[model samples]
Target: MSKSTLKKGILQLLIANVLNMIFSIGTNFLLPKYLSVESYSQIKTYQLYITYVAVLHFGYNDGMYLKFGGRSINEVYNEEIQKNISTLKLFQFIMTICSVCVAFGLHDTALLMAAIAILPQNMIAYFKNFYQAIGEFKKYSRIMNMTTGLTFAINLFLIAVIRTDRYQVYLVGYIILSVILWFVLEYSLQRIKEFKPFAFDFSLRELYENVASGILLLLGNFSSQLLTGMNRWFVKGLMDTLAFAQYSFAVSMENFLNVAVTPISVTMYNYFCNHDENKDIIRIRELVIAFATVIVATAFPVKFILEIFLQKYLDSVTVIFLLFAAQIFYIIIKSIYVNLYKARKMQKKYFTKLCIIVIVGFAFNVICYAIYHVKESFALGSLLSAIVWFFLCLIDFKELRYSPRHYVYIFIETIVFLACGILLESIMGGILYITITIILSMLLLPDAMKKIWNTGKVMIIRMRKSKSR
Candidate 1:
């Protein structure tokens, strides 16, 4: 793809993500406002159960992603796309059936909601990847934005107008929305340049091949979820529904902020994979560093404001601080690889990182809960894993170089924020530490900022020229 095309795609996706985050946060606040913590926690519970459906995906989709990640619209043919979709539909069908059985066996409304959502959710996810791969960002953004808007609107209608506190309402709304989105997504897919409708082609051989390629990716994803998603179950055991609600609330905020950064990761995966040499990856890192710097610096104030407005969720304040802090290191680790292993077909190294994260992350979280018996400890445990992943990126991807001092600086900065968070233990303390760190980091990141600005300047010039044409 041309630079302008890539830039446009990134911009569209970013806007969709930002708006989606807002809409999600709105429901998060609305739910807790009208309902009891217990009812709201049910929504959180429903969300967690839905994640299990993702676990069922088992990386079949990711294999498609790793395969098509860097290619442009014309590079791939319709037949191949049809085959990937066939594999996706099969896996999703199997998972949905399993979810249905589990939901009925347990006789739980939340599980049932999950079962209903699995297929539609999986389809929505497929289209998101599909549009991105085919360079259809306009459709990509439109469909996702529509879903985000409808979801929030329907949710508001349910809670505020209907005056109901049943978390089941949101689940029902999502199932309906997901169904609509699947049709909309399919329509959008049909509009792809020179796209043609095809039958449901089946290939047992191809399906097995797709699974073989992506199972490790699946394991990595499933294990990662165990660390983050399983925390709700673990936290509930440690405390009550309200406590889990608070932890879940914090995570909602953390994940919301996380949405905005995703376009960077998404685009970077393709950008690096499209190139053989490390030079391009290094250029991209400058932009990554700049973005991370801004996200880390602003995280505290944003969390503080959300905490103020959503005072009932006050328990989440500390959790937000800790999780967002960890995301700084997470971004660093993410930027380092750019999904190079998957792109390079280095499944061993890719699987290795996934294994280490799953093992170390699970061990730390469980051990932390055993000691402190609180969600705070769980948050700390995740940060510890991020620290480990940072180093793993350095060692595993030996294709690049940066200053050793750069590595040490990352460690010290991470430790300092973590120490401040643990020691002072107040919103004000976090803001203060963030202030100090921002000042210190400014001293270190001027070169990165300069590179980012230069890149942005070129992008803007190209975009303007394209517009003039």
Candidate 2:
């Protein structure tokens, strides 16, 4: 890639993430204040249900990026790719009908309300993946930012206009916004005249072959979700809705923090897929270290911000700490796993490991719940599950060269930060001590600061040289 393209890609990523963060933070602030705890819990439960349904929408869209994205534009716009798109659309339609039927049959009002909005949501997601697969990062970033901002705007308007406490109204607004966004996306796709819609040309035999591979890939992705979100369901079953609500708040906050690294992760997958050689080893190492440092720095301050903003849910502090700690390991594994997926078509092996993670996670949840009460036990379950998944990923992708020493260092740093900050908060106060500690710790990272300064110097030198020429 040219330097201009690289810089533009980075800028697009920054803009997308910033917009997403704004919408997420806005929702976190507004939703809890507007909805009752039980109502918010209901919304969260429905979100979890829709998330599972989304997993079943096939994994070809994800596999498309790794498998086809590195190729030329003509190759990506091939007849086979078009056939896959048509088949995926048909499958999604069938799944939508099935999901609605199941939701209605079970009389799950919350899930049914969520299901009403899921079809359009999945359609937009598929189109976004298509954009990424073709390396149209600018377009993808624009659509994402616009959609996020629009969602927040719609929700805010509904809150003000409807002035109703009924959560179903919120669901209705969600469905309306999703439908409108889908049409806008469809129009946008049509405007790209090169992206012609092809007739369904693939036979069932061809699709079945690909579907088997897709299912394994889908299961691998689903297993990651299970490791991440299984705690919510376990906590809900073992404890009360209020506890689940608190846990959801903490998880949401952590996830919002992850918005910073998401662009890096997505770009890293594309980068490693295209360039897999020892020649890039030094560059990859620097990227990994930079990425890890960014995540750590962003996460530490955000935890304190969460405490300040959502003071009513202070009880979730322990759960939030554990979840954030788990995220460090999870992010490291994800960084390596992307490269592994790119290097080898080991979908079956990946799926097997995921299955193990799900089973182990379930067992941990059961054993913990049996031992202690729900809230505390669920937190332990999440921590243990993360540890197990990280090790399993390490063993499976042994070529990645991630070491126990690296993990040990990360764990020690995180513990020191948390322990000192917590102790000071207890002795002094929460807000003032946390703010001071965050500022001090951030300044201690000289290496990260040095990288930033050197990059700035290079950019300035380049600008001056261009002007002289």
Q: Compared with the true structure, what per-residue lDDT tens digits does model 2 show for residues 1-469?
A: 4335545666678677897889977876677767788878887786777667657566655555445654545555445555666676667667778778889999988888766766677777777766665556777777677776876887687677776667777777777877888778766765553444534554565456555556777778888888788989888776888899988887877777567766655555555555666535334543454455345444445456655765666777677666766676677667656446644677777889889988998899889888977575676687788778877876764555544545554556556545643454433333443454344334544344466678789989999999999
Task: Pull out the clashing pairs in model 1.
Answer: none
Segments in model 2 whose C-alpha atoms lie over 4 Å from true places: 1-8, 72-74, 78-82, 193-206, 278-286, 293-309, 403-405, 420-453, 459-469
The global C-alpha lDDT for each of the candidates, from Candidate 1 onward, is: 0.71, 0.66
lDDT at residue 235 of model 1 (Cα atoms): 85
**lDDT by residue (tens digit), candidate 1, 202-279:** 677767776777778766666667656655677877688888999988787677655677666666566555555677
User: How many residue-pair clashes does candidate 2 contain?
Assistant: 0
Winner by lDDT: 1
RMSD to the hidden true structure, all candidates: 3.3, 4.0
lDDT at residue 265 of model 2 (Cα atoms): 56
Off by over 4 Å in 1: 1-6, 193-199, 415-438, 453-469
The candidate that wins on TM-score is 1
